[model samples]
Structure formats: structure tokens, C-alpha cells
Target: MPYPPDVERWRELVSAYFAPEDVNKALWVILHESGGNSNAIGDSGSSLGLFQLNINGLGAGLSEQTRFTPSENIRQAAIHVATTNNWTPWGEGALFRGEPFGSLGNKPYPGDKKNEFAEDTVAIPGQPAPPVINLEDIDEEGFELFSPSGENFEGQFDGYTSNLEFAEKRILNLVLEHNLSFDPNQGYGKTTTDELGDPVFTLHEEANMWSEVFFRSEQGLERISALRDSGLTTAGRKSAEAFLDTSILENAAGQKNFDDFRSRIDALAAVENIPIQRATDIASM
Candidate 1:
């Protein structure tokens, strides 16, 4: 069977940058680091490309364009690995310390869990296969550490407005009214309504995915800009700044958790000016 196009591309690049003996190992690392997505931007936009390198620190001297390009990104990663003589720059490397390669084959080394990526490899047959790391441990922890949630709204709007409370409320309402919630099941953002025809605000999972999808589109940016220009009491300006910073797009998992969206509607009912029942009715509507 053929390799995934992106995976095959990375394999060739890795082989070019690494020694014949190390090509398999390099391929293993790239698989875990990026799952072969050259455009994969993670670590809240601080990292880019196949290696998810933080060029500002360990990736020092790499230009923005170089970091974003797959070939250049892989080349720089190979250089970084050669210079350090280890994999400390990457999460899996740093987390595992000395055992940067994880388990090598069908068996788990000591405490290491069995890695399925090892099975996923396209072996050359007769040659020693590369060790595919068990990244589940890192993934669970990383998701918790990096997943964006509504709870971390602190400083999100700094320099945009001082009215955090009103701005947040207005933003939530706008998100609901504009049907910005993305449904992956349909590959688009759409308004869902209950039996009464009241709009159903996005669920936490849907909202999180939508944050990533919506912020990547032109419409999302225009909306953010419009909101920002609307007023200090609204979140458009702050959101726009976040949009520009890629905080709302590439790094949305850090700021767009939808639980807050759900709670805010209930809280909005408590506002003395809005009357609880009316607020509830508005949410249902």
C-alpha cells in the first residue's frame, strides 16, 4: 500500500536531511510531531512546521518564512537535532528525557506503553525498523495543558477595552446570533434550534472546533473587526486583536472553550436590567 501523501513527502525530506542509518528514526519523530501536516501550527502559534519548533528559543535565527515552509522546516529541524545531539527541543524528547526514541518495536521498553505508530510504519523489510514513540501520554497531558477554554478569558482583551464583562457578554450573544458555531458533522457553521425553534448555542465540543475553523476564515476575521469597531463595551476589538495574533485561529484551543458560552447565558439572566425570565427566553430564542 502507498503511504499518505504528506507522510511520504516527509519521509523523503527526512531521508535527505538525516544519515542513512537515522532516516527511519527521523521519520518516526516527524510522524509524532506533526502527523505529517506541514501546515500544522501548534503550541499556541509559538511552534510551526513538522517539528513544532519554537524557533524563537531553540529555533533561534530561523525566519518566519523558513519555519512555515515544510522543506525548510524539516531542514532546520535536522540541523537543530544535529547541533543538540538529542531531541530535547521537542515535547516527546523533553518529556521522555534520555529515551527520546520511546519503544523500538513490538515490545514496550520497561514502563513505556506499546506504540501503535510502530505498526503504522512502512518498513523496508529485513532492515531494523525505527522506534515509534507512544505519544498518548504526551497527548493527554498536552491537551489538558494547551486546550483553550473559556475560563482563561483573563487578559484576552487587554489593550482593546476595559469593559471585560459587557464585552464578553456581547461577544457571546453575537456568536449565537450570527450562527458562528461550526458543526464538524456538516463541515460548516450552522444554527441549530430546539423544538420551540429557539436557537441552540454551540455545545462545548462543537464550539471548540468551530473556534479553530471559524477563526481561520475571512468571515470570522471580518466579524471580529466589526465587533471591535462597534464599541468598548463589546469584544470585537479585543477579538480582532486576538484574530491578528492567531490566538483565535491557530491557537484557539487556548481561548475558545464553549463552557463559558453556556454559563454566560444563564448569568445574563441575572443582570438586573435584563430580568431573569426575559434573559432565559432570549437564550431559548
Candidate 2:
């Protein structure tokens, strides 16, 4: 079934969070289970969300708010797939052969000594007797259940793997470009307030600012200290003040202001060779 429009949006959001290869594998499995239709929350009450998660009795791990949101749902679903795939059941099946029993020979003949090969039945030495090998004694090759003769199971498995790889790549690209956060421990769920708590700036942006202010500037520390001390009402100044007070940043409404202040300080330090001691002296004033 085609994904619901809302579900598609959710898929995009999820793709933004994972690697492209992961996205493909996750989406493929989700389609197989739920066809990407959020409404298909199964009659058995076992399936939920896009992946048809079996929430049944499982404690409410996924946030209720995220359970229904397409973006959040997909994100959680992707995480679910990753988690399940990592487990011995799913991971082994995908990584190794699905049927390990087939490696052993077929059943042995009945009444045969364990591990003993079957020999022709013997009657009196004078009379010839039909060979009476035990049915259980036959060591025939075990049945190939997953890949039955004339079946194209290999092709199907290959297709699934390919899809998984594609999804993973797409997801990875999205994450790199958007700075999406992930927590394997959290699995997939709505972005917690804490998860979204960082200043709403990309890592690259933060790194760049840090480099200019601390590395390039001769008096980088001093200038930064001065900026922190400056009673400026600018967004950057406010952010610095907040940073000084809390030592932690959040994605609240004032992040932009704080980020701007951070950038300005970095730029000033880069452009001016303000000595750290001098900046500190100014800050002391």
C-alpha cells in the first residue's frame, strides 16, 4: 500500500535522522509489515505506527505525543528496526543463514545405533535377504526450507539487503546535512525536551565560532571574557550571560540571540588581536 501523505512526511523526517542505507532497510521492513499506513494499526492489536509496532502490553516507552506524529513515529520506527535487527533473532537471520539446521545431514534410520551407518540386513548365511536399512538410518541432506528447490529466495533476500543499504545511505546524508541527533539507548521516539535542549545551532556552526574566538584570536580568552562581562543587551550577550550562569544551553526561544552573540564574539576575537590579559583587564572593569 502507498504510504499516507502524513506518513511520507514522517518518512522524510526519519530519513533526516538516519543514514541512507538504514533508511532504506527500515522503510522496506516497515512497508512489509504495515505498508507505511499509520491507520493499519492491526486487528490483532499487535501492530502500531508505521512499522506496526506491537505495543500491546509493552510499557509506554514511546512518548504518546510522538506515537502519532508522522515524523516522530517514523523516527521511532526506524529506531525500532535498528534495535530489532541488532538482536540475535533478526541479526543472525539477516547476517548468517536463516536455516542453520540444514547444515546437518538428514534423519538417521530407526533402530540404528546412534552415529552408526546403516548396513544391509543379514539373514541366515545361506539365504539372501532384501536389504533392510532403517529409514532413520539414512543420512540424507536436510531440507532447505527457506530456499526450497526452484524458489528464488536468494533473489528476494538480496533485494531486501539492497533496500536496507540504500535507506541507510539516505539517512546518513540527511543526518550530516541537518545535524540530526540520535540516541541508540532512547530508540525511536519524540524528540525529548532534553534531547532538543542544545542551543539550536548546528555543530559545525558552534565549532567554527569556537575556533575563531579561542584559536585565531591572540587575546581570544580575554576578549570572550570581556564580551561575557559586557552588559550588552544583544542576543549574543544574553546568550553568553545565560551560558555563564547555567553552563548549559537549550533550544529555547532565545537560542538565536545567544548564537548571534557567540558569533559576534568569535568574529571580534578573530579580527582584533586583543591580548587575553588585556581582555581580562577590560572584563574586570
lDDT of each: 0.44, 0.35
The numbered model that scores best in lDDT is 1
TM-scores for every candidate against the unseen true structure: 0.32, 0.29
| Candidate 1 accuracy as lDDT | 0.44
Per-candidate count of clashing residue pairs (backbone under 3 Å) = 6, 32
RMSD of each: 19.2, 29.9
lDDT, candidate 2, at 158: 27
Over the stretch 1-285, how does candidate 2's per-residue lDDT look in tens digits? Answer: 435443343444344434455555555444444454444444544344454444542214553323433434554543444445441212213422212221221111112111112333324334443323232221122211111011222222223333333333333333334444432222111233446575332333322222222221222232235343554324444455345434312211112123333344334434456565533332221
Q: What's the lDDT for residue 216 in model 1?
A: 31
lDDT by residue for model 1 (1-285), tens: 334555555554455455455555566666666666655566456566566665565556665545555545765666556556565565444324123544321111112221111212223334432223222232232121111111122222221232233334544555456555434333224567899999865554333333333233323334335443545222433444345445434323233444444455567656646666655654443
> Judged by TM-score, which candidate is best?
1
